[model samples]
Target: MPDNDSIDPTEVARPSSSRRDPEWLRARLDDWLPTVTGSPATITRLEIPSANGMSSETIVLDAAWEDTDHRLVVRVAPTPDSDPVFPTYDLDRQFRLIEHVASTTDVPLPTLYWSEPDPRPLGAPFFLMGRVDGVIPPDVMPYTFGSWLTEVSDDDRRTVAGTTIETLAMIHSAPVPEELLDLPGPGETPLRAHVRRLREFYAWASQGRAGSPLIERGFSWVDEHLPVESDPVLTWGDARIGNIIYQDLSPVAILDWEMAAHGPRELDVAWLIFLHRFFQDLAEMAGLPGLPEFLRRDDVADAYARSSGHEPRDLDFYITYAALIHAVVMYRIQSRAIHFGQAEEPVDTDDMILHRATLEAMLAGAYWAGVR
Candidate 1:
């Protein structure tokens, strides 16, 4: 594993600075918690995590309600001034989806409290849930660089990877809520609709700016090689071990519902596989071992097959699609970084994507052959 000093700061994604003031948020919560809890409440402590997401803002607070101390989390939609990552954030929809999933499925999730959709109290729509305490694979240092995940025994790491696949099985098996469908319009397959949305997002992200030729070609490739449609299921759009909160190598709370949608099982499966490879590639580029054996594509496919009793097919298409999806998001993120003056505009727009080489290799059908 690479030491902290050896890791280039610019290579990692930086967390966005807080848009709302801490005391201001505490005051608002003090005034607002009573209305929802039906009792007077006082905020004892409040903090915005340094590891807060680049998209939505996360507020962690300890409050006294009815003489009981509550450790809670607030998922707040980004204010308009913050230059949000996605075009829109539907906190209410996400809250309702979590509620439905919790009620119907055994998939572990944080205990949801209340969703404030009005955006009047907190300067944006926000939802509250019980705080889950556990380890999450660090994205800043790229977990593979050095973390509990890298320090664990191979057996323990295997348990973590296997159980995460089982969690994916559980999530896919859950009954889909109508609102979560995100169904395609007439005559469009779910996979096509998914790629269509990605195109639209890329357009929005790169509007009025120099767009990526690589991303444009990726879109074209996706259109030419769209696969035979499979029955749609609820896919955790941002599927990866990093999104999961784990204790003792077991997932306790599966978080981050912002990207939840209905799509083929392979969408989630490929994402889980590709994301780890993304980080693993970063580690190798830095001349580190980086858990090469972890989340192997074949191992992930076989594990999902055994867990779900449904074999994954057309992975070449889906995995490439996953890389395409990630490239767009990374482009948006880098765009945001440039907007914030944290990074300078590169001579080539493709330089904005941290994994440009990986995506290019995947496009050329040369990536997997070199994986082993």
Candidate 2:
């Protein structure tokens, strides 16, 4: 089986289980590529990798069609058999959002080719896009944990962080096409929409077992300190440096819009800041040298403000929300681990929230001072 090289930064470090049946995929692409692309479609190289993305599966393939050879990527929705992390997998919405954002903003992204809703051909609804070559900052080992990103100069690191925030500003301030309203709009109250989605995810992730009391506390905090209403715009939900594909020291394409939404500007800003902090804290615990100064909360907020001309607000609330969102994701990862028989259920589920100390400090208002 051929494989596409990728980075899976899982906290638990599970064995690779993503499908890599290249012969099967070759046959499928051989037959299906022509319908979308023109005739003379030939699958030159196909790699159905099992090493990246714990949530959805990505297929990398090169095809020749109509006197042109092209490199492309296919994204498939998570199947029920895979214990998908998020409750929903809207590939069409993801495709449309990428298309919509690319047309209006300067943000770099893959070019779309086709979207398939039927599962009979590949056993999943998938979409195809031109492949953009770059490196993904690893989550498991972490770029801060001695990767190429960490090896770069401090000035280069700062540029990577700065441009990412600038690019995010580009996304937030761009006028979302009215045609996109036909697709998901992140609901009337985007923040509450996020909370409700989280609640649904919590119920699915619990899987008839007990839920996280700490998560409950996190939700309570969110309710108590909900930020004032402001103008909503299209937000890149998974806004973090790790999600950016970097060529040399600059970001080329910002991937992973699975969590994209229309929400307050600060939501994406806080997620970017807090996610870097998340990795930095992990490196500290592991006695590693994470990029502690690269994406500081204050720095990114200021960058967003300066770049987008919109005032950054409620950062404390949103960074804490970012932590909660990540905690929910970690719980889902643990649930998948259990479902895959990776580890036995532990007595204390609180231990599942690896950043319990960080969340507690945030809840107590002691965490922001240290990071800022």
Candidate 3:
């Protein structure tokens, strides 16, 4: 960690204007590793994935210090050179939430070792967690297109899906300690609070470009359809089997807390369902199989009910809200690709966002008219 007096969490930290040159990146890591290990540390292996995560920078490494070896993963806030995916990056909050959840409940998570807010160590605030060996579904090729899950039998698929739901149930059962981490304010339900933050995020992401009318429509529809009540519990914001690390067909570590928050249990439930749908939709567009039958909505809902003893409710509202949030995220991500010179400008701003028809049908009530 950098010296506490040198950095403030609120003051923005930016990386170099261009991606750090190879030599600079290597030298910085060489200098930073020793400070982390309490002695001179030698890197045995290091990898920073090339895939776009739209959240934080993930660094996976193996190192040796003082005759002790360790495998660690560090998640760092983006530098200015690497424009961030969100309006804010609070590594401290994420670290505390994981610690609290790991100690308070049975939810599986990577064992967190250190959280250093001082950016001097690596030019950005970050936390290090022990890396458990497991196979994570790949986002680059996309697990839905072809992966271990596709090769497995339906029985194995059901077992994995059910275990993931049970894990979510355990996470939702965790106690909410507002003092340790941020929570929704008075009079606002968790879902509404989340929506408010997302609106602010859209505003930030929309600057210097023609904003999407679809996003605006989504915001309006979501505001009018707020649920009557929502249970405030820990929500795994990016809940999906893809985020889980599996070994021997069981989740060894539940990863990704950048979107973690206190919200209705239904928020995570809806996300787990809708994220898969988003990918399934992508596969359909390409004319490929995408796990259409596995992780069925009814099966997920039933599994949650049996495990948690509280039936999920108002999924129509929550799932649509999840899609709305995801669409806005897609717009921002497209803008990012433009900034980094990956994709050509689209004819219409809405073209940047995926699943437009699904979002429209959701608002018309046709998407879940009979189900919800």
**Candidate 3 segments whose C-alpha is farther than 4 A from its true place:** 1-26, 368-372
Q: Report the C-alpha lDDT of model 1 over 286-316, residue by residue, as the tens digit.
A: 8888999999999999999999998999999
Note the residue pairs that clash in candidate 3.
14-80, 15-80
Summarize candidate 2's per-residue lDDT along 98-180 as a digit string, tens digits.
88888887888888888898877787789988898888788767666888788888898888877787888888867855455
Across residues 1-372, which tens digit of lDDT does each residue of candidate 3 receive?
Answer: 001232121111222233434445556777877776778988777777553254677777677889988888877777655777787788878899899899999888898978988878678888889988877776646677888888888898888888899999999889886775456679877777889899989999998889999889999998898887656888878898878998878888998888887778899999998877766665555567678877778888999999999898888888899989888887887777777766556787877766766677787887644322
lDDT score of model 1?
A: 0.87
Q: Judging by TM-score, tell me the better candidate of 1 and 2.
A: 1
Candidate with best lDDT = 1
In model 2, what lDDT does residue 194 have?
A: 66
Enumerate clash totals for all models, in the order shown: 0, 1, 2
lDDT of each: 0.87, 0.77, 0.77
- Residue 44 lDDT in model 3? 79
Q: How far is 33's C-alpha from truth in model 1 (Å)?
A: 0.7
How much does candidate 1 score in TM-score? 0.96
